[model samples]
Target: MTKLKTVVAMAAASALFLAACGSGDSSGSGGSYKLSFVQGVTGDAFYITMGCAVQEEAKKEGATVDIQGPQKFDPTQQTPVLQSVVSSRPDAILIAPTDVSAMQRPIEQATKQNIKVVLVDTTLNDPSIAASAIASDNVGGGKAAFEAIKQLAPQGGKVLVVSVQPGISTTDARAKGFQDAVKADSKFTDLGVQYSQNEPQKAAQIVTAALQKDPDIVGIFAANLFSAEGSATGVRQANKQDQVKIVGFDAGPDQVKALQDGTVQALVAQQPGKIGQVGVQQAIKALKGEKTETKVQTGFTIVTKDNLDSPEGKAALYKSSC
Candidate 1:
């Protein structure tokens, strides 16, 4: 009887222990909700920083997050990844669509599965399908890029834009904003926009050819990280670094190094971390059946060589990892 009593007490303790462990898995008032974050591409600093923020915010809410993306920023590759995530049936998904049109249908399927979808950093043509869309003011960031270039090249001359492919909503809006801003200013001549196809080599070739055609090009606005990197290299290869001023859109580590080395003049840094944080918040709100914001536009910072070490500049810079 003594042995049996001891065995029974041990069994009761084990059951309580198991129950406590299960409850500790989620601390929020609401049960744990699985979340998925799909980036425009894997290995990009901008998206990496956003993913880090998403993980941090999810942890605070006692939620679990899964981050995935394609090797390249292509809809063909991202579509498969999105479909796989949808099949897993996470409670919510946060994604940065590669192309505005191509990603529409794949994302629609997620919505049809009753998954709460949040668009972060990029959006589709039919964004109504998502619970909320959060991103920087891309058009305004482009305009700000032009403004930085104007400050670098006060006399203005011919200015050109090296951007990603046309179908990308963010880069396209950035190119338009820069071109429109240049058009408004008579001192600046818009040399038109060139597509880099998100290839650094292609962007470098484009910039080198543009410089060869018009050696007098004064300013260049690179709409994204690869474009800026290649533009800086092209200017250096042409030995025109002192002549052409470059304003890049994202403040990746490479872009900041370029600014420090005097290869680039200024950078427009978007609030990607903030975008990701808000994305998770919105997703949780939707999962909880609370009011969720349809659209949220984050802000940007203009980083230059002079203020590169400032607190704001440090905060604005993108992270390679969490």
Candidate 2:
């Protein structure tokens, strides 16, 4: 063949090679992978931070991600949003189900279309649809809260649990764990559990009602970020902040302030950012037909006054921005 002809043939082959390797393509060296993320609710900054984490990490993986959620923490509201997200038929769907069972059918339906489904920051009742799940060990965190409160209260007086709405696996698990832990100690009295729907104003109202029912409440535990803040608000509004000790689940700027001010004794901080990062990587692995764990526990840590300035807390706080 002539030299000119050989050069042309080589150029054609290079173009084909680039296309196959995704060198010039949009998806991860190949082309961009469109991801659909359905969060539980956008009320608290924690979930927003979770979405940010996924977006940031997806950028690193060269994957495109879209995060969506309901305006509130209501399962009924999220159900339609999840359906809409699935309709787009993206490469993968990551979700924090509003209700464990309510979201099962939709997620399972998405899975049928060969779309990868990852459960992050929470789990669903129907487990088969999930390729992998990344969430904190809420039960363990609840036990940790109980232990901390126990140390502060040699003889427990009254304890109230302020939490988000029901059916969400993460919130439910933490509330149950806190209940179990408090029950384990016969000295403690349960003042009952109330749902805040993960709204600050609603949580404050719930706390106010609980205090009205029982004036001797001494220890308060909130199951998630919004509820925790609400618990603090109620205590302050009721003028009971001086008598009660508060322990919050999940961390945020307000929760950190609550801790500093000695209002929130400690915070059971979930690794929300890590959950996002881990979920996206697992989704990538699943897309590549690699083995992924069915249950991936990103776990959590207990943050208190002692470690507020420590390297671990600072590192985690910086990463999660909580």
The top-ranked prediction according to lDDT is: 1
For candidate 2, give the lDDT: 0.76
lDDT of 2 by residue, 72-142 (tens): 87778888998898788787888987778887887788887778888987778766567778787777777
For candidate 1, give the lDDT of residue 2.
Answer: 8
- TM-score of model number 2: 0.86
lDDT of 1 by residue, 1-322 (tens): 0010000000000111011111121334646889999999999999999999999999998899999999999999999999999898888899999999999999999887888899998888988887788887888888888878777788879999999887888998999999999999999999999988889888899999999999999999999999999999999999998899998988899999999998988888888898899999888877776667888888888888767787877998999998
**Residue 306 of model 2, lDDT score:** 79
User: How does residue 11 of candidate 2 score in lDDT?
Assistant: 8
Candidate 1 TM-score to native: 0.91
lDDT of 2 at 233: 91
Clashes of each: 0, 6
TM-score for each prediction? 0.91, 0.86
Q: Per-residue error at 253 for model 1, in Å?
A: 1.1
Local distance difference test values of all predictions, in order: 0.85, 0.76
Evaluate candidate 2 by giving its C-alpha RMSD to the native, one decimal.
13.9
